[model samples]
Target: MRKRILGALFSYSVIGLITLGLIEGILQLVQLQSIRSIEIARKLYQLSSREEYLGRYCHSYIWKSNFIQAYGQHREDFLSSSGLHVPHKTRGWTTKPNVTVEVGEKQYTTNNRGHRSQKDYQEDERKYSVLIVGDSYTFGSDADDSYAWTNLLQQKDERLQVINLAVGGYGIDQMYVTLKEEIDSYNPDLVMVAYISDDVFRLKYDFRDYKKPTLQVKGGNLEIENTPIGGIEETHQEIKAELQKEDIAILKLDDLLFNLKISCRYPPYSLFSKVMGQMQLLAWEESAQFLAVYLASGAEVEEKSHESRGEEVFQRWAEENEIETLNTRPYFLQGSGYQGGHYQQAEATIVSDTVYDKIMDLESWKKFVETNR
Candidate 1:
């Protein structure tokens, strides 16, 4: 009886193994295994730091999704070769003055002051000027220089001398510093500060590919650190030098948790959100005719379900300070076909028109111009 039971158990185990092999074979035949393997690899890729996540994660997944990409992104050539930006001592980086580069199919040209304007800025004849500051969205990422919302705003009225002081990948602290440095020289009748969601959390990081200045609040007072960490290559070398001497146990439990995707929605980030709000408010207090505007992209809504924590903070502070604020969420994907990413020419037009309408109709923006002009 013991021998018979042992034989039966062995037969059942063999059958189960055969069944599992058959299922795996079916999956392989359907190409599901390959697809799932790619998906799993992409997820693992996303678990890396943001720099690696952005610069690396999208390659395979994007290529798979957009089969149109025979090779990776063609625009990489323009991005790498474009000597359109120069390192700055205090502000981190700024657009190079008087540069004309062909990005993809479009020609992007900067004025003598390094702004991507259709024509040079005429300071003497300016009647009403708007100084717009922020990161790539404000810098008109992926859009032609002539079509960028700032330039479009200038086209809205001949008198509106709009200056675009936005650089790609700038954080809130950098924006504040840029505004402080340029506000007096630009002397605009109205100042528009544009920010996307990441600008808030970016305040916490000292390095992003290139080293940058960052800010922290201690005992309710703001403090700055890591200013002018050198240019891109220099910063890369500096980080490499530090990493070379790094301890083996640097990846703590908290670092592991941070690596998880859920950490972005964790409560601690909420505290950073509040701090970011306060930082923007402080910056606003420094400018005379400043209006905070949140640029919403279709990609943000598709990727994250919640409204940006930074936007919430900004709206609350704007209410308390009675500062003019605009959320461009509605403008996104409305007849623009802006699926995600930097705006195309049509989307840029819509955004510029929407902002122009807000300036004309919104009481806060109008009041600021009237009072400050």
Candidate 2:
């Protein structure tokens, strides 16, 4: 009897170990398949930082970059690069003018596809004839740096060399200063400002927010403030200012349990989101607004309004100074083909399900910029 019991225990132990091993193996396999199934950039990201381009990040079978702003995204998801709005990198507007060369410590390289490229960072080119500046949209959030507006701008005018000095998360204030400092060095024919609506206005809230009017006519000379971002007086204190709008709707633990019980009884969008995610064949162009708007959080909806307001001021400033200002939003918003929609690693939106149209039209914007700018 004792021998039989001992034998039984040994058999059980062996089976358990095998079971655990199999589970781990299966998990790893699933992870691998998931990585493979999802599209990734074909290149490897370099180590050094490029001051003017989108940073990149990569892993085996997986790659990511912040070059494309996933519309209506929060500070969630995998961060493979120094993404916009993170506030950790770039030292945020406090650095000195002209002397502030990009350091190697924190820059990454990202391609157009949400994939991180593979390459070591190195200062390749410096001498450029024309420099363009703006926010993520101007910075080419969804596409590779080469596909960005500035890159397109470069192709259009062969005689005029171009530099995309647009950084992510920057408002007009940074644009004003960065241009003033770099303009003399590059010294070109035109100062083209590829202003993104979302980036032009200086919200009384954000730190880098400051707007300069297009024209201040003093004795008939168009006077541009173009001040270094520091001199402006701040109105609303950021840290203490209470949020007036948007209900975040945080749930308590008990409420979560009750909701979970209901979810088990019924079903939720989680399953639908998964199914839609699996079927890559969905035509984003057919139903761009439906998907994106449905998933849009209230805060995101509000941002659209902000972008419009900011664009007005920025355009005025650019025009009065004889600086060329271009708006690329409408072109991207009205895309008609597949190339116009479907972006990856976008800022995870509340309206993630139906945002294919916006993704497809990115090229149209780039193309227009290339031709016009």
Q: What are the lDDT figures for the candidates, one per model?
A: 0.63, 0.33
Model 1 lDDT at residue 166 = 90
**What tens-digit string does per-residue lDDT give for candidate 2 at 13-50?**
99998986664454334334334453331111111112
- Winning candidate number (TM-score): 1
Error of 2 at 190 (Å): 1.4
What is candidate 2's TM-score against the reference?
A: 0.34
Evaluate residue 93 in candidate 1 and report its C-alpha lDDT on the 0 to 100 scale. 68
Tens digit per residue, CA lDDT, model 1, 220-240? 665666775575456445555
Clashes of 2: 34
Give candidate 1's whole-model lDDT.
Answer: 0.63
| Count of backbone clashes, every candidate in sequence | 0, 34
